[model samples]
Target: MDNANTWFDYIPFNSRGKVGKISVLLLLIAVGLSDFVSASILKPYFERLRPSHSELEGLILLVNKGGKYGFVSSHAANIFAASTILSFFYIHKKKLCLTIAFLVSYSRIYVGVHFPGDVIFGGMLGYLIAIITITFYSKFVLNKNKKKLIG
Candidate 1:
């Protein structure tokens, strides 16, 4: 487990084992793909604007293009998705993963790209996707180890 932790931390620096590298790559790809699909497919359908562009006009701190749709924040969705998957692999560091997830989601609103509601919804969607993926992986890929541990 210590080796796994070491590898996890060093994966981006080219000091990780093959499994760790593969895990990180998969997590990134999954999150990226999900975020892209959510933004492209769902954002247009929802077509909601940020608070800065809404009736709350002066209440929001406008820093960017505020009139654009902001239903599902891509930043929030992608980071949440990555964090969720990391949490499953780093169960002992669950709190850290969650904290990072919160920060990532909050950054979207702080940067004026999305509303609070957008981050909230995106995080939820990301979490659901992570749960489904993790469940499938555990049930199939880790089934043998699970039975052995249980038995």
Candidate 2:
């Protein structure tokens, strides 16, 4: 949020053990999937224009305009996916992770790139993807290991 580079900077280094490494990998995959879904799939399907491109009467551009379509913000989707995964790994840091995601998502609106609806839907989509990825990881990776240990 405050610094764009800090999102996944220290998490990988700080995380410990096999689970931590796998989680970091999965988190990266989640972010990639969110971005791909938002930008490549949904954006093309919806074909909504960015507010800057729409040319509203009093719209002030704080940052350079983005691509043509803005149905779902990739920034929101990626950050939310990262935040959701981080929260799963560090339950105590959920607030910080969510706060970062929210701030980054809001920045898109602040800079006049995406509509509120776009950001909201992107965030929801990212959260859903993260939930699915986490469920699969737990059910397949963690549970299988547990079963082996028990057996």
TM-score for all predictions? 0.73, 0.91
lDDT of 2 by residue, 1-151 (tens): 5785775565765666876887788898899999999999999999999998996999889988989999899999999999999899888889999999999999999999999999999999999999999999999988999999999
The whole-model C-alpha lDDT of candidate 2 against the native structure comes to: 0.91
Candidate 1, residues 96-117, lDDT tens digits: the string is: 8789889988987886777798
Best-matching candidate per lDDT:
2
Candidate 1: Cα lDDT at 116: 90
lDDT of residue 131 for candidate 2: 93
TM-score of 2: 0.91
Each model's lDDT comes to 0.74, 0.91
Measured on C-alpha atoms, candidate 1 has an lDDT of: 0.74
